[model samples]
Target: MDRAELVELLTPDGLTLLDSVGETDAVTDVVKAVSRLRAEGHAPSLVAAVLTQVKLRRKAVAKFGDFASRMLFTEAGLEQATRLRVAALHAGRFTAAELSSVADLGCGIGGDAMAMAAMDLAVTAVDADEVTATVASYNLAPFPSAEVRHARAEDVDTREFDALYFDPARRTAGHSNTTRLTKPEDYSPSLDVVFDRAATQPVGVKLGPGFDRSLIPENCEAQWVSVNGQVVELGLWFGALARPGVSRSALVLDGEGTHELTAPQDSDDVDVRPLGEYLYEPDGAVIRARLIGDVARGLDAGMLSPGIAYLTGDRDVTSPFVTTFRVLERLPLDERTLKRELAKRKIGALEVKKRGADIDPAVFRKKMALRGSESATLFLTRVDGKHAALLCERVR
Candidate 1:
């Protein structure tokens, strides 16, 4: 939305309309609601703005939870905003250090800023886009300690702040077409500028989990965080923000709770061992943090192949950092052989997972064409650096 639409949304009548648009209101029913509001003599622009916000707020719940009720969002801003649970952890870092304030560069929709303010840390949040900055200002209105600015992150002076939080814009122009930029140099304000700022101050740079590891400095601490089994972000902590004796870490958060494994450096190498009674799929965060060996050691397991993240052991061990499975059988990667075996086992639904293989799971699942009574997960991966498949049951 533009500045004009946002200004209109702040009007008393517009506020009343938004209040009427409940979370239970069906998104498909927006057109009917708009039609009814227009019939009631409401201006078309105001009605349109209310309808649009109703939808955006509904979508924002995944990131902001109940707080989304009072927040505003842009399509792109919401897409890039950090999840509230994750942002709270980011805020905790500053609070734990006894830092009084932080400069949140590229604070999209004020998600992180709100978290910081909730932790009682004063925040100066900045965004380059005018509309996004205005939305952030509205979202942060309840927090007197937080301020929002419309300007480039590079232009922000952080000398007054205790630390900086840099979440660089990693995508190209326009909110509609989200074309991701692959190179760090292409990022807004550039990765170089962020790195330079980080060198002199305690800073955290939030990057995509798949960011180029080669560019990360040796002295900084890199932590990969995952939620619900999906790796969300790779955070590089610099200077005083870096945890003592922790150069790499995997932080996993799920319904059960949060778990973290840290090492002074990368995990030490472990010997490759044969597949046994159980198989372990390390959490994405563990793999990204290069701590696979730590999980392998925790499970009394070993890698199935050199450079492979999968771990195998003789017993089923429980850990929050990995998903364990009982191996039913190991099969050849041959499609005809696999199809016959699956059909014989009465497997109907299959959750196809793969690594170190060139095949797409969706395409391969269709080719299996199984018709049976039970469901099972199929792992198509490399064992001993050779193509193979494993039929397994999830240990839960």
Candidate 2:
């Protein structure tokens, strides 16, 4: 949006209109709301903007909860903003270190800045884009300790702050339709520059979960965090901000609560064993953290294959770090043999899962000819490096 449009949206009257049309659920409701406002003498542009913001705020409830109602979000900024729950954990690192001030370089809509400020810390939140900085300012308006600046992150004087936080923009060029830029050097402010600052000052760098392992600095602590079931982001902590004696960690947050498995280095690998009565799929955070071996050892299980993340055991041991499945029957990899085997068991509805395999579930399911009285979880994976299928039931 242009500067004037944004300025208009922030005006008392426009915000009142947005607040009045709070949390629209359907297109019909939005249309009705917008029509009512337009009849009340509001401009079409103002009505359109307010209706859009209300929809975004409602969708944002998943990430920001009730705070989303008051906060403003740009499309790209909202997509990249850290979830409030995870931001609180990031803030805890600074809080534990007794750091009172932070510079959130490349801050998107001030999610992290809001969390830090709530914890009684001073934050200088900076973004290179003018529109983004304004949106961040609106979101952080209640936090007087936080300041938003529109400037290149590299130009910001880092020495003035107690700590630095970087969540560099990783989108590929075009603003209209964007793709993820994979190379670290392609990142704005460059990974090299971020690492350089980390050497002299405390730094926390947020990166993609699948970031190249070779580039991870020797002195930094690498952490993979998973919310619910999905792996979200990889966080690198350096110097005083780094957790003591913890070089690699996997943090899992689900309905139960937060649980972590940490190691000073990559955990020892386990030997491959024959398929057992049960199968376990490790959480994405565990796989990304390269701590699959640690989880396997904890459950007294062995790997199904040398490189596969799937584990097998004769016992039904359960851990918060791994999802368990009970193996019902092993079927031939060939489609005909699998169909015959499944038909005998009267399997119907299917939940296809795969890892270390090339087969597509959608295409494979078409061949199953599902028409039975029962439902089952079908495992499409390799057994000792050979294609195999296991009909199973979810333990949960």
TM-score of each: 0.97, 0.95
Off by over 4 Å in 2: 25-28, 173-176, 343-346
Model 2 residue 96 lDDT score: 96
Worst 10 residues of 1 by lDDT: 22-31
lDDT of model number 2: 0.88
Cα lDDT tens digits for candidate 1, 1-396: 667887898888888888887655538776678778888898888887888888888898887889988887778888889999999999999988888989999998899999999998999999998888888998899999999999999998888889999999999865445789999999987999998998788999899999988888988999999999989999999888889999999999999999999999888857889889998999999998889888888788989878878888987788988899999999999899999999998899999999888899999999999799899999999888898999999997
RMSD of 2: 1.7
**Candidate 2 positional error at 180, Å:** 1.3
Candidate 1: residue 39 lDDT (0-100): 89
| CA lDDT of every candidate | 0.89, 0.88
| Model 1 stretches astray by more than 4 angstroms | none
Pairs of residues clashing in candidate 2: none
Error of 2 at 322 (Å): 0.5
Q: Which residue pairs clash within candidate 1? A: none
